[model samples]
Target chain A: MRVPVLIRRPPEILSSEITDEGLFLNRRKFVQAAAAVGAAGVAGSLLRPKGVRAAEPGQDEDKLTPYEDVTSYNNFYEFGTGKGDPVKNAHTLRPRPWTIRVEGEVGKPTTFDIDDIWSRFPPEERVYRLRCVEAWSMVIPWFGFPLADLLTAVEPTSAARFVEFKTLHDTEQMPGQRRGVLPWPYIEGLRMDEAMHPLTILSLGVYGKVLPNQNGAPIRLVVPWKYGFKSIKSIVSIELTREQPRNTWMVQAPNEYGFYANVNPEVDHPRWSQKRERRLGELFKRATLPFNGYADQVASLYAGMDLTRHY
Target chain B: MNQVQWVRRVLKPAVFVAAAVPFGLLVKDIFGGTLGANPVEEITHRTGFWTLTMLTITLGVTPIRKVLRLNALIRLRRMLGVYAFFYAFLHFTMYALDRAVFSGLGLTVGAIVEDVAERPFVTVGFTAFVLLVPLAITSTKGWVKRLGGKRWQRLHRLVYVAAIGGVFHFLWLVKADIRRPVIFGAILTVLLGYRVGVWWVGKGRRQRAGHVVAAGASS
Candidate 1:
């Protein structure tokens, strides 16, 4: 102590070494301004939808296609045939106050209000790779519960072998319906087993927010293992049927679009090769995987069937 | 200035700038990152569109000259044809980059050869582009003089075939919406029809003149 200070006195920091309070505050303000600008720049490039965030980690290595690309570049013939037409014209769609009619070979035939389905299902997020038959693809973060859960809730009867989904048929709401684009009230279907697969979902939202109208607002089907067209949009009805439901594309061009529109690279479309697909936000075309890279999860379902024949 | 001088100095420059506008705008869009998510597709489409447009315009020049009695318009035809070739070249380049180079195929000619051989759409598009090569090379006045007017005119008629191939290439590629390609087909039809009508009228006039000369000689 007095003889020799037990604790050595710490060297004092010079006034120059200590940052001035005004300068520190100014630097923080500058940093905040820079950060705001950087965020704005990212938002501008992405044209991000409201309330949407980046997908949670470990979902995918491939970057999520920007929200703008997902919404704007749509193939919803219900809106129009042009790639950009959906975003331009889909505002006419009324997504709220919606109901989905569930019937046909079910124990409980009922129409579910959109909100009721939302609360009952309570959508969880799933990132999926969407492959289009047109040889383009996107990675999308879709929010939905399993389609099996909904099917179980409806209590499908033993006679149910297929699940048929239909879109709204109003010409006023969907202007493309005014023209004979693809036989209105676009229809899609899946085998009961395929529908029951956990990978299959009835999507309520995308990018962690309510879906934009162009991306099939309120509710749509998301079959991650199949082509984008197989996942029909804006469902007004879901029917469990005995026979397979003829889908819109198959009805329109039977030779071109098959009933089972699974993503098969070896089975090419009549008009073009399905071997390669241009991923959104990428310059080069990548080799398309069988079942769009979800073969591990879904290959067992089609173990014996010849995909080429089915495709 | 006289009309010809004005056309040479002012109108020609204006037309050149007008023709280049689409390409310039495309370049701006490319650099500005406004070509949307799939820039290669956008580039391919824009170039293809302009190629078809330029071909149509080139084909329309003769008819426009005859209809409006503006003989000076003939001067614009070669320039327009060259512009069509320009766009076609860009379109083909983009395809090669997409299918061969950027596709991680290592920029081999073999990859491009395979594309042209295997893909029917590419086959037709490549044919159309190949058809433009001789025409583009011999576009100058010197080559026109060397080939002689009749031979040069006969050789350049290949443009009609190229135009047809271009239309079919477009028609074959589309999935469902054929409206745009149909419109292009319609325009090409009207232009070719007009050319045939003019040829028929010229043949009739030549036959009549020959018969009159024979009658006078016999009398």
Candidate 2:
């Protein structure tokens, strides 16, 4: 069932030119490979190939997109906007030179490099639905440790009631900065309990592969219950604080964006109805599920609060 | 008016240039695949907006000609009209692909078209768009020669009706934020109003003169 494409292989281009143009193909080829691999994808299945171990049901990692899909195609603004932009642009990010600074209401304020942090917390697999503010939602199987586990290791002080995360602020890396739409070096925050919630994950990879730069490769937060923006990406710093943290989107359009940023049907945006969403892949087929249908798991978090206010 | 002609000659590109700035940015974002999520709507809205914009410009051409005392202002009409068709085609495609238009839900064409009517904005927008299809087809130079100058001018007056329909289409489409459509509507009204006022006043004076001549002859 495979058809061969005729290609006349000429002499390879020089290394510098190869880096310039040839590097783009690696990302393009990654997509081509994913499409090829998808040829074997059975209907409505999460990539359970023949003879290879299928992820068992109830296993969080079982229903995840492969890591190659996760890291390469992402919405991590720290790297860039498009799923492909990250892989193409993240090389310039200097993940090696990156170090996360932690402070605010902590007895032992610690600043750690990417190496020290990963070696300690390690990566765990969690299948979570990422619902974007713009109405598209996706089911991603992310590989990362729980925010609670990481916080426990760091020992947040009792005074630390809020946890704020900051993305790397380089006008060079984050092209959105050039436009100044929502203040650069995007910042997001969560209440202390929400930050420590087991459902909250600091994503490292997806689909059993490393994270795509666009998908917040290297590191990003994944809050399954809330809208995806609450799950910040390309994190460069973490601050433990008592006061409310300044978030980018909420600051820009307070009426449209909310602090909790949960997936709720009752809370409609200024322009569009939140009552229904287009499920990914089923975008042309099925309608979206409400609370992204994790209401059973996350509804308790917003039991008494007026969702309209939080919305 | 030599200076005036020079300015307008420069401004013809400037209008297209101004129009293209947004298209370029949006295109770059889309082509770079940087439009993020819900991409289909992003492209739809962008293209739809330019459709209305170019239509507004096309409608503005005649008034601009009269107001500026420059006959050459009429020259931009053809190019602007074509651009309107270009963007309008994009807008039409977006809607046709939407669930409201051609649903993969196995809905009948009658049902699909009915669903579009159920949404008032879509209904009005569809009406305006359908009205433009005839205008677009008749814009050819051959069609101009075929209809003859007077008939063709009469036929192309359909562009005025299309412009009004297009603005109303945009106004109906939005649920809130009437500011944008209202601004566009005001501009379109002024453009159309200029011609209507001139026609009405000229007709009234001619009628008065005819009455006087008839009375003089009778007396």
User: Model 1, residue A201: what's the lDDT?
Assistant: 88
Question: Fraction of true contacts reproduced, model 2?
Answer: 0.04
What TM value does the first chain of each candidate achieve?
A: 0.81, 0.74
Q: Candidate 2 on B1-219: residue-level lDDT in tens?
A: 575576577867876677667768876885675543445566677788888888888887777777777777776788788878878887777667654422324333664476465655667677777777877888888998888999988877877777777777777655333567888899888888888998999999999999999999999
Q: Under CAPRI classification, how is model 1 graded?
A: acceptable
Worst 10 residues of 2 chain A by lDDT: A1-10
Clashing pairs in 1: none
Residue lDDT tens for model 1, A14-108: 22343443563354345435544211112222122224323221223355566678888999888888788999999999998899999999999
TM-score of predicted structure 1: 0.87
How does each model score on lDDT? 0.82, 0.66
What is the lDDT, from 0 to 100, of the residue B129 in candidate 2? Answer: 77
